[model samples]
Target: MSSLENILYFQSALGFLANMVLLLFFIFIILDHRPKPMDLISFQLTFVHIMMFLIGGNSWLADIFESLNIKNDIKCKVTFYSSRVMRGLSICITCLLSVAQAVTISPSTSLLAKFKQKHKKYIINALFYIWILNLSVSSDMMFYVVGFTNVSETKQMQVTKSCSLLPMSSIIRGLNFTLSTSRDVFLVAVMLTTSTYMVNILHRHQRKLKHLHSISHLRASPEKRATQTILLLVLVFVVMYWVDIIISLTSFLLWMYDPVILTIQKFVIYAYPTITPLVKISSDKRIINVLKSLQSKCHQIF
Candidate 1:
């Protein structure tokens, strides 16, 4: 493999492993009956990311499918459709994560606080709807993707070595773009609004903490820590998400995909998923404590 290919594979491997570990931790949390409202969301996010890596892993799966004697069109359709669905789910879940955290930290008298007692039900319902929406929104992938044959066709947007996006009519393209852009804009707007609210709450909370005690005596609560971690995640996600969008827009305008640009876009796409698990592992006291306890037990056994 070329250097670029090697690097991309390494990136995919790292992200897949990190997400897997985080998924396991979230599962443990849920099974132990100690899960916070956001735990379920995080678990779903981790799973979606894992799927992202598996489906879009530098088109490695394409080669595997070929080796397995899968038909070209079937493989292309399956791969692209699944990839689009997972990508949609990632953004939706991340947005939901931010909103859920905002509700979680809302003051008891606040409007959002009413949902707190029944937040799990609301979250479950939201997830169901999100799945339905994304599945429908990304349905276009099945129609547009085909097995690449190096046909030198302008209407085909080469996605992987094996899969290309077949062009649609101007009206169809416009409709698809409008729907996609609208969905993304609405989700991102919600994410940012909640994030801003969280910042305000954190700021006011810091003031109260300062009034109550000296800096040395003040410690962050678990809730504060989780909120801060999520804020950081949201910031990272928004940056990466926009970068991906800009690349997509550039690709669309040019009506072509430059290989180098496509590679960079993939890197940007996976950046958030790779960093998310590391950030959560470091910032979450629960995960940290679990790791420490496991280490202690290992030492005693040795």
Candidate 2:
């Protein structure tokens, strides 16, 4: 196996491990409480996105097996479109989370702050709309994505049963690309604006509480803590996402297959789902308590 193949396997295995951990995190969170709408959404996103990655990864591995004289070809529009929908939802959730955190740190007198307070009950409805929008945006994939088939009599160099985009009008492809890129750019812009505001808020908060604070000087209000956690998530996400996007775009533009870039791309894509659960559980006392109790019970059983 070449270096690229080895890296591909490594990336796949890493994603599998991260998915298993996130799966457990979701299970424990659900078991710990009657899952709220947002909780359910997180669970759905984590589970579905990871599964999509696995399916995509398996599709790639099928290509590898074919190269080695094995017969395998599995690719369909459902898997392709499902992944796109889940990815869009993931991006949407991150934007929403950043907005929520920014709202928390906003002065209660602000109109945005007031709106958030008044519409707290409507969060699920808003999220539902987001789901609907993503589904609608990705619906085209169902018709356009088709399983890649062997072009020759003998299988060669088909390391994956990749899907080919169906021939469509240039106008339609351009529109689709524009729409998807706009969605990502818009959310990223939202996150950056809110994140800048949050930094100012945290600075002021820290200054105001400086004298009254304890030894480590790290004691922060719950709102501040939550905002900080979210800021961290957003920062990490932006860095990973943009780097992945840049590499991806460049690779397409240059028609290059650099393994390092490919590995980094997968890692960047996987980073958020891998890190989100840890951040969430750390932020929630209930999750921590449940985790501790479970750990103690496992000890007792062993």
Measured by TM-score, the strongest candidate is: 1
Query: What C-alpha lDDT values do all the predictions have?
Result: 0.86, 0.68
Candidate 1 weakest ten by summed lDDT:
149-158
Q: lDDT of candidate 2 vs native?
A: 0.68
RMSD of each: 2.2, 5.1
lDDT of 2 by residue, 66-154 (tens): 68765322235555666778778888888887776666568777767775654445566767898899888887756765565542532
TM-score (C-alpha, index-matched) for candidate 2: 0.76
Instruction: Give the distance in Å from residue 79's predicted Cα in candidate 2 to where it truly belongs.
Output: 1.7
| lDDT for position 95 in model 2 | 81
* CA error at residue 148 for candidate 2, angstroms: 2.1
TM per candidate comes to 0.92, 0.76
